[model samples]
Target: MKTKYWTIVVLALLTAMMSVAPASAKPVTVKGKVTAKEDGSVIIGCSVLIKGTRNGTLTDTDGKYAISANTGDTLVFSYIGCITQEKTVKSAKLNVVLQESPEALKESMVTGYTVGESVEDVSSEEIRIMYVPVRQELPSEEYNEIVENGFMKVKDTPLSTFSIDVDAAAYGNMRRYLNKGQLPPADAVRTEELINYFSYDYAKPTGDAPVKITTEVGACPWNPVHRLVRIGLKAREIPTENLPVSNLVFLIDVSGSMYGAERLDLVKSSLKLLVNNLRDKDRVAIVVYSGAAGERLPSTSGSDKQKIKDAIDELEAGGSTAGGAGIELAYKIARKNFVPGGNNRIILCTDGDFNVGISSGKALEKLIEKERETGVFLTVLGYGMGNYKDGKMQVLAEKGNGNHAYIDNLQEANRVLVNEFGATMHTVAKDVKLQVEFNPAQVQAYRLIGYESRLLQDEDFNNDAKDAGEMGAGHTVTAFYEVIPAGVESDYAGKVDELKYQKPEKTVPVSLSKELLTVKLRYKQPDGDSSKRIEITLADDKANKVSVDFHFASAVAMFGQLLRDSDYKGTATYDKIISLAKTGLGKDAKGYKREFIRLVEIAKGLDKE
Candidate 1:
């Protein structure tokens, strides 16, 4: 009986060994490639999971993925830029591709910024900020810097983007005056400096609508020291039928300077395009400027589109620029035909090189200082090359309570007019300024990135009459601050005497508000510019999803920060920027955002010189 039992045990052991053979070879192999449906970018970091098994692998550097799974198991490939995908393993090798995700728009790119202490904690009240862009490194001190104004035409697109790039940089030798604990240079502080110094006022938007503030801040991809920041605020696009028809006027500058394919000619063609798109209810007027300005055409409705087109066509570049005369006449014509609540505006199309009366930027600004009281908003459309006056245009947009745009070609005209129509005309808020009184206990020393030209005297704020930039319907404004905690301090800027006599300010906490910045908007109806002010605060902490807006804004702000030559831009370049942007690229429905990343890449490549 013992011998028979031993024989049965040996047979059982042989059966167990035969059963373990199948388990030794983990035979489920998985492989696939991940790509986007639109631009065909390889989807990296995508995970491939073998359903019902404990096996998973990520896509390789090339967006091709591999894993091991058993037959009849499901394979899942998941990534950030594309929709999650799944495939059933019918064969040993499984192939997978990803589609673009539709939910990217609702995502935010920026995380929250570490804020600094409130003003009360600081020892100084008089804060002087010096704005500086990264200057190209010169092998020698006197390399002879070159400043030029040029235009760029996109591939297959008629639009030409204007640029006034500076080789903006400074060396230890450049600031000889700033030696031994000296301050920054004055030439570095440009006209755009003071304008960019103070944060403009704005009104906080409500509900699910997003406020878009898009800007580029970097050494001109073409010219290093010359930083370029183009701000595009896209509010929720409103249907044209809901908004009132604009009672428009084309204030064309037929000055001697306005002669060229890039100037008067482009303006004429751009205006003709507008004439064709006018609504029946819209009224039109024309004002031309030369050595003196004149009313080229009186107000007329779109029923006479051909008449306006003919007048626009009749415009010929001649004489010196008499912008002051044109401004006065344009206002007069607008007043005579002003319609309450109608979109009444005189679009100033020029090269911004005003040599006539009130010709200089300050002079032209003062000239229209009182005219804004008439309630007719201004839209300064800059044209021409060589003498492209960005300074004059910025000032007019600020004082006249309007917006400014540089038009390089016809495609740009459509982008400014057709693509960003409501933003071009509709004023949702005006005189927008940003004010952040950080809780000193929570923050320390903070630095605001960019806006070197937008800083303001604390007193300049809350002064209702002070002029500021305007915001369009559905527009969003974004700014960034790199905070250095109060407990710990570094010598970033020059220390001054105000640090001696200053006492820290302390204030009691009131109701938590959503206003991250107190947006004080002062605007008049399209025709009634006596002006009105609306103040709202934007907050971004718990109990307020306000942080949500801050997230998107922060990402953009960080991008701007990464672009500028900030002392803290450690490893913060285009590669990281694309990564962060890819991570937070929210609902990118129209692919404008995808194009933005592409632009970043292209600009990186274009500016490689």
Candidate 2:
């Protein structure tokens, strides 16, 4: 009887200990690749989450992901436009194949029209026989007019000055047009943005200066008689771990116009990518605007990523847009939680449609300009297709001492928010302006390829009070000048009557120098009030063999001119552009260059129509 009682007591103690013990199924590292079921193409930026938990990760560029999960825990794989899938984690390696959602398929269908018959040609009686896809009425899209730059006589205007622009909204916006089998409006193609969209292998800054300059001259691809000069500036790169703590406000527009998968939906996904990359030291607040502006999420630690993402996911589109009110509230929040000497920025995501108060571009500009004085920079992210207000977004970004980008797809989001995180969020230099002084001895007449909107008074370069563009860490700025060599009898270099009241000024001794041009740059440190200046001289010698970047940039410039139907695009053909891009397609690890070639081909077909 004693032995029985002791055994029973021991069993009871063992059962109690077992009930108090931790779970036996320890979390193991699970690795897998995510791909599409239809074509088996790898899907990038897919979210892999452990069921019933906040633990999740995004797939890398190769569609590979690793996550910790228990043996019986469920793993959920999801991506925009793909159906969500769940699988039990039976083993360490579990690959996932997601199917395209039916909604996505419907949205992806392109409108088809019967060939060889114009809508006017079809009679009412025969209209039923014509095959035409049903589509919604076209929305009125607005784009500011772009007047191409004209050649200036070096003797008359010796110095060409402009603010440096790192925005690449034009490139992605242009790509959207071509992808839809249509040509972009002439005013929509910004040449400099197209060239700067791709990364270049320029030398990094080695000194105290945040930017380094590289200059090269080569024979113009379109007009061989004219020389092409490339000026490249590479900003110092800061590693992700070394970046400053951030105080970010996500100012999102949730207006009635944003009610679509491509507008608000895309904005949410893009912000999530950014949220996933945030460090624990950073903080984020979300401000949304519809009929009224309100703060959906207060300033929260970056460690609470799930909370931030939940706020983003809960957003829905409705009512009118109170953009000005939203901006005011966002700035207020940013200033209230201001992190001294840290990166404080507001990221505005919208279709740029503002129907309520302070909707005009000038008003928005003024409001942002005032808010910018509080040491908070702005980053404008334009989204959606129809009714996109590019003009207003441009003014806000330019006046707010910030940068602008257009997010057209998930891949673009990955590129801007993930791959180029440092360059997209951290500003190392602000108020950067460039001035080029042409030498009459080496060049007769020259025209800046683009940047008509960024032209600055020659005096503005020396004025520290003037506002200019900001450069982010790891950002690269590229500009091109098409030069009419001295003695070239071109109509572009038309003779100007000698000044009636003044005799020709004596040529300076520097004109005798072999330099083609002097490039001067001015920029202020992120938090500094005063500006610093740097100058570099480009020799007259033309490069016998230009680098791959130079060739690719020239191709992009020619393509832009062609798209815009500029008066200066001499002998530029789509075939020539494609060939040049092919020659310059170095490594192309990201495949952006190859995509450029494909876009050129698509444009060629659309141009014929």
Candidate 3:
């Protein structure tokens, strides 16, 4: 009887203890902001990860982030150029400030043209210790000349025709120069690219069309006497889950010139970010070049992200650049693993320093042009600064029906590879050309703001065979035209000598219409060879108020002109650009426009020096 009573008492005690035990700690939402310790500026694209887990998120434009974590769990915060931090999830909120890492800063040393350098006498350890930061301009950097477009009389040149350009490399490259406390070369300042680098609030296509067009006319901030016409095209946006399968070929330049942290190292990190975003349906192949071309990674399923990342991490920079060979190998791999009616692209990451066979711009253009016809599109991602061949990159991208971008930092890499993935990887429209017919009655003279190299013959607008630019999913292209209204006398509208042998042609009756201009666009489906045309006529709607985008884009254009010291930059000053930019700083959620404002200030200071 005593044993039975004790057993019952023990059971009761055990049951009571079980009932009193606490449940597993429920996960709580942890949120915080990350900033730089030096300037207290919010750090964009910072990576936040939960310890011992694959769960991670990047900070938004405002440097704010949220993630679920259990009590006592550890959180890791990391970013390029900043020291990594860790904190225990003791509360629902934990802010982090990362100090600049000295080691990371030292890795940014500019080593100019290390190709074919004899290092046999120096040991690897000695070389490491001797590698120090050199802050001198590299004379080997190259740029194509850009001549400003002159105003043409509307009567003589009613049609302004050009291929649409989506490349923003010039803007980023210019920013690199400014960040180094120097003005970018005039040839590096492409006005249209600078204006189009920032996103604008344009309407997406509602119908089967892949692109939508928006137009606005406003008084030019630089020259109040002239009107600025803004033409914008917005590609349709597709959700991440709904995107087509992607067959990507990563063409990496492992040449000696790309040995710096800002070059090959940045490329690896950038590509790793891309790998993280890949879907199971997507496949990737890596082709690298240094003196020769070779496949580093075969076509692997995106599910094997770690394997792909490992391949990228193993790449080392050395030897002469065999860029053409890399291109050939990449395209071959892309074609071998082509996804029909899907995204098939070769992403060429390089500093554009090609010294081996088929290196000239014309020869590279021909090679890429021939390869591009195989239904494989190209994307040129430039890296590094000294010995950068911007001209070669531009030619390859332009001829290959591809876009170009310069990745100056890891934040820029995140912007291109993570935030704008679809727009950077997938194509919606190809061979996009625009022709604007101005009404002689409403406009006396007009000139295209930029696109000096993109000018197409008027007949090329309707020619389906002529290659032009490609617009990616959710991509936005903007063009600005300075218009001198009828009867407005300006120096830009120069007097021309009359031809005695030529007789004046009769004006069309349609010139009397109230329309200011008619914009016609022609583009082809991603997989189609034929082209389709869209036309829209803009009337002189004086009631339409100028949008914030107009002001912001104009400010960028003015800044570009100032950088170039263009003759047409009338009354444009850094102060004026800043004030105009502030007025247009609407809902800058990503803080890109805010960053632009800061860049303008930097440029102003550099100009004074």
Candidate 4:
């Protein structure tokens, strides 16, 4: 009854406007001002374009931008990190509101490559270069003319959104932030330890079989929310048979904040484990970070296991963390023992809880930005969990020309070690990225979920030095995206009124283009310093539901939706995910099938609360 009443009210308003004009007529005047930042203090200069077409308008002196868009046109408002808004302008006067880009606050880190840092930090001596290959939304052109020219205008109200994904790699090389249900205070956190938590699964040296390793991107299919990413390391991984001698450095964070068993103990235990796994051919060094920084161990060989183990066992955690000091000390150690090519690397172990000195973006960016030129690659291992600064860890890794991961326990330790050796130790591909160009004819209004921080600008592509994600030899990463089919309508989140946009577009079903999206990959040999390339294209078949990529990816998406409690989920539920996964258990080669089923039971139990 209420819905019907609202619809009647909407139609009545439309009728009144029609009386002032014609039935099949032009757009009615709808005006609104756009204010920038808080209280509209700053006039924002931005582009107002329709979703698909390139037609748009630029903000004027007052940060006020205007564009004529009709009942069905999806208006896209964009400016840096400010959320890109999309709307279907009904009665035209849209006093658009442009909020400040959250990234605008402290977005100086791109990958681990912090600002004021050298571009080379995005790459390495072996990597040569790195770039954050990205794609930004384009403005709509044709639709704007229709509204401005008064060709198409619907009297009905429409839907709109002021949402845009933050380019995580852009500001701080972060793909994921610490999923805090609630925010944590600074003084209680240790920034350096947070920066180094992920277990990177380092492989032992072998003769050189080009060791293969693997890890799952997320949880067992059973419990989709708890995605499990396994890292496998092996012997002879990243063989030094022909490589230069590496001047290795270890940077550990011993802040007063890292006084817990999970923080300090985890670091010592993980380091001890990694030390035991080292080969006689490798050299090692250690540095620590607190309110101040210090070097615990100088360049030493793997052959002197006792020397390294003794130093590791002698370490203790106390004092506030000075991130800049730790980074500087580590870089200095690497430079002092600078090796021409063997394998210069600084392994950072912390919880990423920097709060004391040099914690700001401009400050840290300038510090790490200048350190990469010496050819020392960085590897960040994050420890602990609560109040974890996952973002900061990713920044250092990205800028340090490395990768980031979170370490919770020993099983995770084994996963990083025994399972993904090549990816952990060898660099099979550098700056690998994914770009999907959706076919509008096949789908409508696509939204990429999660990776909210990974969205990249279009220009970032083609630049070799841009820092993207890293891929180890034989490593597989899975990403899932859910798309709404064209013509599908829902009362919630509808873009336009009536079928105005769908009318001339295609009321009759189109053939549905076969090639849904393309996947392009570029890589470099772990031993070779130059880069190479590879590409694979994915087609949407909508067939063979028995078992397929869509099925798997969809399951993953459903799991994500369930976890995030997204609006897009329909009948999709935890049981449904289990049912689907069980149906397409595939090879079940590793018996992960059984494990998944059990996890489903576990997740169901957790939901009772």
**lDDT of every predicted structure (CA atoms):** 0.51, 0.84, 0.83, 0.48
| Candidate 4: regions farther than 4 A off | 1-247, 339-341, 490-493, 497-513, 522-533, 545-556, 581-603
TM-score of each: 0.56, 0.81, 0.81, 0.56
Task: Give me candidate 2's TM-score against the actual structure.
Answer: 0.81
Could you tell me which 10 consecutive residues in candidate 1 have the lowest summed lDDT? 115-124
Question: Which regions of candidate 2 deviate over 4 angstroms?
Answer: 1-41, 44-138, 498-503, 506-511
Q: Which lDDT tens digits does candidate 1 get at residues 35-132?
A: 66776766443556665543565453355666655666767655433566678776666566567654632222111111111011111111111011
Candidate 2 collision pairs: none
Query: lDDT per residue, candidate 4, 308-379, as tens digits?
Result: 878876778888888788888888888887765456777787877787888865677567657765656677
- The residue pairs that clash in candidate 3, if any, are none
List where candidate 1 sits over 4 angstroms from the true fold.
Answer: 1-238, 485-564, 588-591
Ranking by lDDT: 2, 3, 1, 4
Please write out the lDDT profile of model 3 over residues 447-466, one tens digit for every residue.
89999999999999888999
Output the lDDT of residue 213, model 2. 92
